[model samples]
Target: MASFEASVQLNATPQEMFDFLIDTENILKISPPDTGLSFTKKPDKLYKGAILEFQIQGFGKVQEGTHEIIVFEEPTLFTEKQISGPLKSYTHEHHIVPAGENQITLIDRLEFEPPGGLLGFLITESKLLDLFDEGFYQRHQTLKKLFP
Candidate 1:
C-alpha cells in the first residue's frame, strides 16, 4: 500500500472548513489544472452512503472511479473508500482539527494500491506522487483563499 498526507492551517473555524470540504462541487474549483479531475456524479450533501464518481487524467488517459463515503461525522472527520476504480484499493480520510480560536487544520490522508504490482508501484512512486503534490498544494491554497 502507498500513503500520502497533507495538512494546511486555515483562518476559518472548524465548522466552516468542514462544511466547505464536505461539498463535492468545491473539488472542481480547488483541484489543480493538471489533475483534470471531474465529477461524473455528486450528491446534494455528503452522507455515510453517498457515492462520488470522478475521473482523473493520468498517463495520457482518464482513470475513473467511484468513492463511497463510508464514514461521515459532521464538522470533524469523514472517510471515503473507492468501490471501483483503476486502483486495487483506495481510501481517503479528511480531518478537520481545531487549531485556535477561529482557526482550523485540514488534513487529507490517502492510502492506495495500484493495479499492476511492481509497475504500479513505480508509477505511483513517481508520476502519481507528482500529481498529488501539486493537487494538494493547489487545494490548500485555494482553501485558504476561499475561507481566509
Candidate 2:
C-alpha cells in the first residue's frame, strides 16, 4: 500500500479544527475549485459509521467514491475507510493535537492501494505524494486563512 502524511499548525483550538473538519460542506472550500466536488450523502456532522458518498469531476469525467467513518473520537481523531472507490483500498486518518494555548496541529495520514492489481507497482510513493501535494497545499492554505 502507498502512504502519505502531512500536518499543519492552525491558529485554532482542537475543537474548532475538529468541528470544521466534521462539516461536509467545507470540502468544496478546501479542494481545488475545478474538482467539482459535491456530496451525494450530506450530513451536518460526521459520526462513527457515517458513510460519505461523493462525486468529483476529473479529466472530463465524474468519479464517485464512498467512505465510511470507521473511527470517531470527538475533537481528537477520526478514521475514514473507502468501502468503494477507484482505488483498491484507502484509509484516511485525521488527527488533531493541542499545540499551544490556542493553537492546534492537524495531521492527516492516508494508506491506499492503487486501482490496479499487480500493475499498482508502477505507482511509486513519491508519485502518489506528488499527485496529492497540490491538493493538500491548497487545503492547508485554506485552513491557515480560515483559522487566522
Task: Please provide, for model 1 over 11-116, each residue's C-alpha lDDT reduced to its tens digit, 9 standing for 90 to 100.
Answer: 9887887778777777678888777899899886788999999999877789899999999898899999999988788899999999889998899999887678
lDDT accuracy of residue 66 in candidate 2: 96
Q: Estimate each model's TM-score.
A: 0.91, 0.90
Q: For candidate 1, list the clashing residue pairs, or say none.
A: none
lDDT per model, in order?
Answer: 0.85, 0.85
Judged by lDDT against the true structure, how good is candidate 2?
0.85
lDDT of 2 by residue, 33-73 (tens): 77778888857789999999999874457879999999999
Superposed model 1: Cα runs more than 4 Å off:
117-122
Clashes of each: 0, 0
Candidate 2 contains a number of clashing pairs equal to: 0
Q: What is the Å distance of residue 2 in model 1 from its true position?
A: 1.7
TM-score, prediction 2: 0.90
